[model samples]
Target chain A: MTSDHDTPARPAGLPPYAIARQGRRARYDAASVHAILDAGLVAHVGFVADGRPMVIPMAYGRDGDTLFIHGATTTRIIRGVAEDVAEDVAKDVQVCLTVTLIDGIVAARSAFHHSVNYRSVVVHGAARHVTDPAEHDHALRVITEHLLPGRWDEVRPMLAKERKATGVLAVRIAAASAKIRTGGPVDDDADYALPVWAGVLPVTTAIGRPIDDGRVAEDTPPPPSLAAARRKFA
Target chain B: MTSDHDTPARPAGLPPYAIARQGRRARYDAASVHAILDAGLVAHVGFVADGRPMVIPMAYGRDGDTLFIHGATTTRIIRGVAEDVAEDVAKDVQVCLTVTLIDGIVAARSAFHHSVNYRSVVVHGAARHVTDPAEHDHALRVITEHLLPGRWDEVRPMLAKERKATGVLAVRIAAASAKIRTGGPVDDDADYALPVWAGVLPVTTAIGRPIDDGRVAEDTPPPPSLAAARRKFA
Candidate 1:
């Protein structure tokens, strides 16, 4: 079902659909793409429904080249894809998933050049529902571990009924691109000479002190895994 | 060009296009929607191109109910909208703009309940290129101040040539919805009795020490605006 225009040659390793608007900032290297995807906690999933575009934020995990996302069976994304599958077995749901991390705010001497230092990854592919029991179980584990390393080992195992209530969508990294903009503002040549102060205020996501759910026993302390996760970010 | 299905009754104060899938979490209040949009520094813009959905990240600003975003004139979004304007003077580009902020990671006793506490705002409407000089100028100011308060006054104003080079698009908040999830994970009753720990790990975006652009004079100190911005986030 793919058209010639949709399947472009992978020049410099970048998939045709994932080309960056800025040639200089485009990164197709697998390592770079994986790093950006791994570092991000949330991804914006884009899909077309009834010719209207919808973007929904969801937590995701990457197992090699496959990106896994799960939700309740009633959710729009899951239900929409399910309906599409039912209509035409040969067609998969087309999606464009994107992850962006804002590194810093660039304050330029003029409003025209104001920008932000950021790293973003865009993935384009067909998302298929993972119905196999083994793959579904593995996808859940990957997702839990992706959010909090060592969490899956400590958490109770998924029950048969619990697994059935959840639906996992796996999107292969068929075409992906990463774009990064760093450093300070690049202003108009004449405006840099102005007396205005211009610099980068670095932005970072920090994990604050953990708050217990109050149900934990008084003797119980923060787990080592939680402490390690905090330190990793710190 | 609005269709009957495209326009729905906003009985809850939410625009038809901005309806939330979860009725309980949906917020149509202007205050709530504005707060989420203002706090976020970037927006994921969803648009359709050639029957495919594309979501691109861009810096944006809000003034009253109108949202402003700018980019190079040659960019797909800008170019696409511009072409639409030329073809029909009465038509505007349809878009869905979304912003999401992840507040915490919710770890449940079982893999099925893992989630993230977040606040997200979705706005759906027609985007028109800002051709009015006064509105365009004000939009730039709002954008600069949105990133860093007290910034527009200190920085040099946009030059005529610089303004000409940029394409600014304004999308009125015709239909908007905000969804927020907070507190700890809501786990299954049986899993809560398990010994596994379950709680929310709070996440915050912090500003690190500012970095000078190297071109600034050595004697120049960090502006009070920068300090104020940091304290506001802190």
Candidate 2:
């Protein structure tokens, strides 16, 4: 239902890498891209490894246009970026990061036309290791709060030793695009006459009741923030 | 809890590409790999385009050890593979397919240790066009049933012309590995003493009420298969 007047202008120039094959589905507005990125719980990060493409799912968080991802310092991907810097081959790691939230399964009369209703954001950028202590701390807070709202304040602040072991990479989205498909299935006119049911089966990620860890004291109750999150998605 | 006696033997020898930096998290048994792939609703297919890694989310189905992915013949990924074949660069398209199901959000006492509980499968292999008519039809059936358990039988059979417009690729399970993390968060011993609520917030992909297309007859009820799916998730 997006009309030319209602659609937001593309703030970031639409780079060739971000163009969609189905031009109608491509969106370049910052609002559209950020919304998809915020809704997704995990991002699949694509990077070249030994001349082969490797895609790994990782939890991510965003602050403005910068997306933060972290892993153990010893992990292959983190170390790979470090090696790139040491060799001076590249200042940042080239990556294609994607986040997708599937909204429904679109069942059409014809199998060829069956599709899924989804919102996805694809970002192409060079990720560099975050060196500034202030930015690193803020990025960690963003990541922690993204998964658990109000968690950064509730939990103990990260110890210096723990910070040393974590590798944080910040990728300022150079070029980004959001592709969304919603509503009911779009089938061929001739196939609409077929005596078959066609519609959308909505899909959602629901959060179930919280389970306490064994170490928790019997008197200690679930935090209000945790309980609220469970209720929000329940 | 996985016991050494209960863990299945690794059927496919661990390929260098399948190994995880954290060795303890990697599982190579066919059972482990297949279970993760089955539970996931989408796969992120990684392929090289113009020497840059492109990761796109796709709906996929698994039959035995093989995975099938289909899209419109006009799609960029499909056409890219076709061009590769036409140029005689390689008979198959090199791809890294990944599927991930986020089971829960792990809220740890320290932000550095926060992680998601998930099961993921990564398959490194070459995908080639499924040109055989019988295999193409079977692959389509696998895809239909994978999304909606009994959908293939209830839907109208695909018309010849409909099939002609679809492009399907099959990737054999070569060098596949599964990585899983479950249970509550594991925090540092000192941090565990902090009075912070830390546990797993369970997550699941649930199906909501179906919305029928307006074109369907007023008396035409939702098929039994659709009803069954709703109940399964409910």
Candidate 3:
């Protein structure tokens, strides 16, 4: 569990545009969306660059209804948002951010019926280039702690230069939806009696042994934060 | 290793527009890009829908320079590509596809220096709806076999009705780039002397023991294909 300091309670509902048309597995409540967001480390961000679609994988953190993604200020996406902030017609950078966790692979009697058990959240939003000092600092903390829950407290405060060099985009989700698929594969009634063996092959992101940077004392152990992460992610 | 049957050789080079501007970690050769793509199961496909960007996670397979993504004909992305095929001026649907594999997390004394070791590939191309019977069949087999390698023979073949209901889009890659990051965190020289513990937390995707669908006899073991997958992914 994350330290509950600034962790806002999951915001209520999703916008109409964000509701899944294929409703069987759709989740509209903020809690459902937040759960998947918190569990993932990378988001695939889709945006229009030069009138063409572009997708980039990024490390992100969720704060209630908002998601923060950071990168160097000079990067293309960051620069695009900065320019959008100045444009008279465009007030914010539009993006579709999605995170997915693969839980299992479902094998069925027929190739057509094979499916996967996964949890994914898609957020459509107008993102702003974070400029306010307080919000910027908070976003950084959310990102740092999101990856290693307690690391923010163990590390020194952000440096002025470091803060300036990084860029944070805050995507206040205008619409969001989460889709989850679980359990065993559903096959055709006739195919069920076939000789084929079918089931789910579980998949997971495993946190392996940590290696020392070797700059520190050889015997020094990983900090409390990494230890906490080992337990949390596992 | 995948049971080699019709595995095409990696295509040659990337287009100029697809080449990474941030050249430090960019790989342009087909071999490097294919290695990451082949290792991945899902691709985040980015496309423009109704003048807005949309990102969807899809199962895809690669053959030489071509990538195939299949779905029901009614799906928005599939329909969009079909319409593009009919348009008088534009003959194909343009999209950006990306895949990522997280290898490890770098924990540093400073949060600013923290990073993750990952390998990712981005592909940009115009996709054509596959209407040829032979190509459609090949695409379906590729999609199925991509998930559980060597399982195509273990399952029943796709029926005619199933073929009629599915839409396969072939993206002949026009531009592509792969970026890879590895090893320990690079910290500020002065920060290395701090007493804080720093290291690399290794991460990996693990394939767990298979669970039976229970329709078959309980004693039946997972087929040889799943055994190969466990060894390959592990």
- RMSD in Å for all candidates: 5.2, 5.3, 6.7
Write the candidate numbers in order of decreasing TM-score. Answer: 3, 1, 2
Model 1, residue pairs in steric clash = none
Residue B204 displacement in candidate 1 (angstroms): 1.0
Q: Each predicted model: what fraction of the native A–B Cα contacts (within 8 Å) does it retain?
A: 0.56, 0.57, 0.66
List residue ranges in candidate 2 displaced over 4 A.
Answer: A1-22, A87-90, A218-221, A227-234, B1-22, B87-90, B227-234
Tens digits of lDDT, candidate 3, B124-195 = 887788988999999887877777888888987889998898888888888787878888888888887777
DockQ score of each predicted structure, in the order shown: 0.43, 0.43, 0.42
Off by over 4 Å in 3: A1-22, A87-90, A218-220, B1-22, B87-90, B218-221
| DockQ result, candidate 1 | 0.43
Superposition error at A157 for model 2 (Å): 1.6
- Judge candidate 2 against the unseen true structure and give its global Cα lDDT, from 0 to 1: 0.74
Q: Going through the candidates in order, what is chain B's TM-score?
A: 0.88, 0.85, 0.87
Candidate 1 residue lDDT tens string, A68-117: 98777776667777776753463467777888888998877776667788
lDDT of 2 by residue, A94-171 (tens): 778889888888888877777888888778877888767888888888877767777788878878887777778898
lDDT of each: 0.74, 0.74, 0.77
Give all TM-scores, in the order shown.
0.89, 0.88, 0.90
Model 1 chain B poorest 10 in a row by lDDT: B1-10
